[model samples]
Target: MARQNTVHAAAAVLVVVPTYNERENLATLAPRILAQGEQFHLLVVDDDSPDGTGPLADELAAADPRVRVLHRASKGGLGPAYIAGLTTGMKRGFDYLVTMDADHSHDPADLPRLLAATHDARADVALGSRWTAGGSTRGWPLRRRVLSRGGSAYVRLVLGVDLRDATAGFKCIRASALAALEIDTIGSSGYAFNIELNYRATLRGFRIVEVPIVFTERITGASKMSGRIVAEALLRVPALRTTSLRPLADVRPLADARPT
Candidate 1:
């Protein structure tokens, strides 16, 4: 699964995928992500999976220059893992930073379209939307479909994020937008992180576009969705609406964001 060339130091794009005990998925996922294009580099931020996902990712990184691994001490929540990943991308001066799931629910093939959507629309964030026209899900249970739809709808209504799939995990974010939003300051530590990211970006008037993508249920391993995660998102959405999110700058013009 090794590619001939290493990721260039000045490569413009980086995809940060967070993993926890996703060894089965990682072995199959890394090569596909790398195959997307030569311009893309991948960073696997593993939460020190006791399942040995960390070592597996390290082996992949060793074989391929485009692949890199970030080993965290424990299974921190999705937000912290992503925060660390995005922060690393920005520090390395990448122009684009993308986030994805290691579960293969998010298609690696859709990666380019996300980046392209951001570029074509001059948007700061591109969401891989399952509710948008042309988007679909394969093998997803009806309950999950309902939960995702209802939750995102709630997020949209309460937080004013103007996207059909505001809670989507797959996304491509422009580095400039990351710095502008000050993503590090976001406080949510659970799955609500997706909504929080979009909400903050919208508040800052950053352009967010949706590209229809097919989300598939994993064929291997256990799903991470849990009661606590759902509750966290449910509790966090209203707080985001009521709480005041300070901007990176004291005086910045708020753009009136509308659905696209």
Candidate 2:
């Protein structure tokens, strides 16, 4: 059995926020993320936001030891930003790494539920789902809802993933699951990245679980869900399902053990 302190110390859950020009949202969202008690670390990966979100992240990090910032030169999409954060988290030896939007679409309060699902429910990857029972969406336009539901259904059929909110950005992923992946091989960006990660995990036999979360439209900042992102996801879903290459490692069984 793993030592209690090992599990507790390794249990550094950092909320990874990939940002680009999210100045409006960052100001408000950062505080909310920090307010999720002191259990989580907030990692704000700014793609050198011309809107000054990077400096804001620095300012926030300086104020809070639990907060940190990673700066990238240009807007390389959400996938790269997350990869950067994941790499840093792995190097620093954290046990759990979470990815969510800085735009407030993913609530900070839901963080604890996702964490509990991972620790108590024995899930390798706990997803915050809006399509599951007790889950819902608020303040979204009809077109957005239709697009999301249709895209999710299409991916489910094509990729054969059983997840309800496969495209959702809110997730609590164990570092062990991430270490099992050849993340360097993941080539998709934006929405496609989400599907690719989940698909690869399923292929490696990870114990993924969904926790219901109410999805809400961002109260500030312009939405970044572009047509290109959607199109890329639609295309990548089929390609990933056909790949037979095994992952770098298989840690699904570790997810079976209760979090110490």
Model 1 segments more than 4 A misplaced: 1-11, 243-260
TM-score of each: 0.89, 0.89
- Clash count list over all predictions: 0, 0
- Which digits, one per residue and each the tens of the lDDT, describe model 1 over residues 1-260? 12322323234689999999899999999899888778789999999899999999999999988888999999999999999999998998888999999999999888777766665456678888898777889998898899889987898788756677879889998888889777888888888898888888877766677788999999999988889988999998898876565342111111222324
**Model 1 Cα RMSD, 1 decimal:** 5.4
The ten-residue window of minimal lDDT in model 2 covers 248-257
lDDT of 2 by residue, 143-174 (tens): 88888888789878987777777787788888
In the predicted model 2, the residue pairs found to clash are none
Candidate 1 has an lDDT of 0.81
Q: Which parts of model 2 are misplaced by more than 4 Å? A: 1-10, 245-260
